[model samples]
Target chain A: MRRIHILCVEDEPEVLEAVVRDLAPFEEVFPIEATATADEARRVVRDVILPRGELGLAICDHILPGEDGVSFMVHLHAQEATRATRKVLLTAQAGLQATIVAVNQAALSHYLAKPWNPDELVAVTRRLLTDYVLETQTNLYPFLSLLEADRLTERIRSGPLPGDE
Target chain B: MSIPIRPLDRIREALQSIPEAQSEVRDFVTGDVLLREGDNPGTISLIIRGEIELLKHAEDGDEYPLGTLRPGQLLGLLSLSSGNASFFTARAASEGTLLTMPDDRFVELLHNRIDFHQVVTPLLLGNLVDRYRRVVRLHLEVAELTRDLNAEKRQLQAAIDELEETRNRLVQQEKMATLGQLTAGIAHEINNPIASLSRAADLLHPQWHKVFGEGIERGLTPMFRQAFELGVTREPLQTEIQRQRTAELARLFPDLPRPLVRTLAQVNPESFAELRSAMQRVPESVRLSLLSQWAATFEAGVLVRNVRVAAERIGGIVGSLKSYSRQDKADEDAVDLRQGINDTLVLFGYVLKKFILVVDLPELPPVRCRPGEINQVWTNLILNACEAMGDTGTLWVCCGVRPPDQVWVRIQDSGPGVPRELREKIFESHFTTKQIACARGSGLGLGLAIARGIVEKHGGRITVSDAPEGGAIFTIFLPTGAAPD
Candidate 1:
């Protein structure tokens, strides 16, 4: 059985270290470039990461120096290899519109507001990956009679379901 | 306004014998021009016996009237700086005796006349230092003024953007509300007809099949009964019937009474008991099928209710946003600080969804203020508190009224508190503590500055302190202007 590979993109050196350290213990964690500018990040992904294989997840920093993190995720979605990567945006800002736009357009797996705890991040990412596994398994057999498995697509697309209560 | 001038005969008598003294006397009337600042660049005039008023006129037509001069003080050093213009123009306020010296002679006396220079140089230097200090202070004030203006401009722009967002939200909400109203109305209208159709279908469906089944059974029942009655009647007929029956029996012999008959009757029974059992199956099967359909109908009802609820939610959200937007600039209404805090919590329901907000708000009377701007105070502080904790931590909001009618609102969080060094400057706009997107926080720093401005505008204050739970706490105090007449 193949496990999902996560690509963590962060701009801050300390934070990048923390993310890698947190995820390395549980899963196959791949660290992308911790660049000062968004251009450098884009170059690193294009020139280096895409050649590896399909990415299962992309953890993006929302505030980067040259270009914003949300735009970068949109770019990632445009790429064939990384389009399926589950996206999570990390931000410290308090306003709502930016968060709404990220969730709406980026189809993010999660939004981890800063300053986030390491343990909390690990828990959330782990849950998301588990959910991804269930989804993949459900999609493999399209002819199955089980509506429960088939309904995952709708549940994910609709965001948080009302029955989540 | 007019005071008599004293004669300085004593000073001249004291300095007359000095060999370096070069002095000339002049007479001045009231309101005479004693010294045109730039005209006599090096001449020092001694006020002998009257009052003098010095004036400085700028190019922009602004005149500065310097204070009155006394008998002992010397003038003309206002132009001493090589690159500076005369500080002001001077004029005699009353008729007076004056002692004057030429520019070159004044210079010579400063070099040779030790006693004269000693008394004069220290006074001049002191005045120069004072003027220099004022100029430096003015420059600093100008820089600060520039920064403040820029901040205000940014604030106004943010407010305008917020206004636009609120307007768009309102319009969208109104449309949604109208659309929802239409959907409900249409649903109500169509439900009656659809229900009637379903009831009619239900009434006809079972009866139509029953009628079809009974007609076929009735036709078969008479034929069987007629045959049984014919076989049972008269002796001769019975013998003939017996022969015929024997032939019939030969055709339908022992196989009919065999186990297959019982099994066939059990599987597809033809007796009255079997017929009743078969008839019962129709209603049971129909009920089961109808139950599945009813489940679907029930789900649809739930969906419609959900839609109604959603439309109402949108309406409620837009209503609050409209209030938040308009309240921002409305007149300074009397505000209950505690109530304002509660409203802020409601306004930031989105944020609270991700974070746990705990309130320890005090019960107090209204604090006179602009509720709209003060609401911004709670918003910024509370948001900052949540952001500091990354929106998943515990937040504590406390409010109370102090003596002399000052109200305070404090919001604390469970994330890392502010560092000691940065506490003072955190309220400065654009400051953030997050690691990623320091410039943007990646977007959390806008609220604190806005909050500070609002509090100050209300003649109140805001500050950040350490929370009891080891995070950061923001405290705000609002001064109630006055009680109603």
Candidate 2:
């Protein structure tokens, strides 16, 4: 029965308002927090707001002002701490390239899209939170340390690095 | 002009005696590699019996069948003009005989001797012209066949893409439906709590009233006690509290009747001055009740609105989907090219809204056409024009009546013109300038070809040429008066 803190980042104001209003009725839910700029978002994630174990999850906008959601998540993944929170990148741009990169690189949970139904938003959040809580409750560790040495080999074959040949 | 000449039989006998001319007499066996394509530089083969097949070598070293050489036909004459190495391999087919004559001897026989040149040079030139025309015709025929194949490929791909789009749309729809059902269930689940909240608000309204009335009664009784102690009447203060409570309660519960009017006037009449002091707090109590009721009402309103919207939205969405999913089943009849173009352009209104569309369609009689297919053609062309413009640019469509009774339509866009290298094969299968991800879409190179096929089927032709304004121009000419009225 613990409250989950969600950080949402988006560009458009109307869509943000709709999301806030839709989720307002949940008394158990805190005021849905949002940010516009990816830089501000990164700062929120690192230094000011989230810190270590403050924020539970993040739903980021794929297309943003400076750094897109994928690149931003890459930065988050690089951080030593506070990288374990579940991440979902919401996008309107079709195709799975950005989604795949963001998910695989950052070990993200799922992707959601714009004009999405409110129920879907809740369901995705619930599922993601459940996984996070399960891992934490059971004291399970999930990391990609074993695959780091073989990164270059995989990149030459399939990763997004240039000079693939 | 007067000269003595040998008889035809003597000339034939003399020519037959030569070794080079002897092959004109026998049948060549199968698998006989008669003459390597470049073996004799300008040797001509005269087929006397059986057949000789001409084969051009494909880049993969495979021999591609060209045309066959029949009896009494001469081959290799084209080599005279094309001194470059022969581009094909020649094989003796089915026991055929070919007389291979040296280039120099054949030239001499036709030029040096006046009688020989007069009799033979004209025949050679005539044969050369015929061969030239045949090659030209073959090239055109091959081009047409290629165009047909490209069109078929595009249509097949379009059907596949449409099916995929439908599948995706259906999946999205199903997800939406499931979401809607879940929403309804949630709304129903939450409704009970909202009703309980309203009931609690109702029960607290009466208790809140007593608290205000009792407080006013105590305060007023004290004031009266003090007044009596000082020997003064308390009627003025008592009347004041009664008036204040009525106005405050009306304002607090705007939707409901004033609570003080019913409670103070009918139920409690003891110590009117004391009751007035207690009624002062009645306004604040009623305000609290109103706030609780408002919250409960707001929640119920949202639940009902959300479910209603989900149901209504699903119907509108399914309607749009039904229209988009029907392939090859669109209504067909005589359609105005202009109207069809406009209708097709509707799908790309977002694209056109950013650009200036200049249409110069000459007013003319409507043409009998396949409405849906023609609409697709116009849609593809217009969409292409919009894409070429990228974010913003100009698009021009010119239509008029061409000579010999044909309707001509041309669409032009101000984008980087088609590259010269790509112009020839732009209508070829799977050819596209769009990135594979955003390729519009699965079969882009096929659009023009499909358009060309539909136009041609209706006895028309479609062509692409450089636009006057330095962009690509697509021209469609449809034969007028369908099937002779």
- Candidate 2 falls in which docking quality class? incorrect
Model 2 lDDT per residue over B1-485, tens place? 42333443343345565443332444579877665665545666556577777888777988888877675456666675566666666677788566566676766665566654554454455555657888999999999999999999999999997776556445534644564455456555655655565555445444444544565432443432322222111111222243355445556545543322312222223443443454455577564453333233333333333433444444434333322222333344555777666544544543465477787877856677765456657767777776676655788987887765678888898888787777768765456777667523553455665556567767777777787668888888886664443
lDDT of 2 at A115: 75
Off by over 4 Å in 1: A1-165, B1-282, B327-330, B338-343, B429-431, B434-447, B482-485
> How would you encode candidate 1's per-residue C-alpha lDDT over A45-143 as one tens digit per residue?
665455554455677776554456787777777776666677888766534655666677767788888778987887776666555545554332331
**TM-score between candidate 2 chain A and the true chain A:** 0.70
CA deviation > 4 Å runs, candidate 2: A1-22, A25-30, A33-85, A89-94, A105-107, A112-165, B1-331, B335-368, B378-417, B434-440, B455-485
Question: lDDT of all predictions, in order shown?
Answer: 0.58, 0.57
What TM-score against the true fold does each predicted structure earn?
0.36, 0.37
What clash pairs does model 1 have? A93-B443, A93-B444, B55-B89
iRMS, candidate 1, in Å: value is 37.9
List the TM values for chain B, per candidate: 0.40, 0.40
Best by DockQ: 2
Which 10-residue window of candidate 1 chain B scores lowest in summed lDDT?
A: B260-269
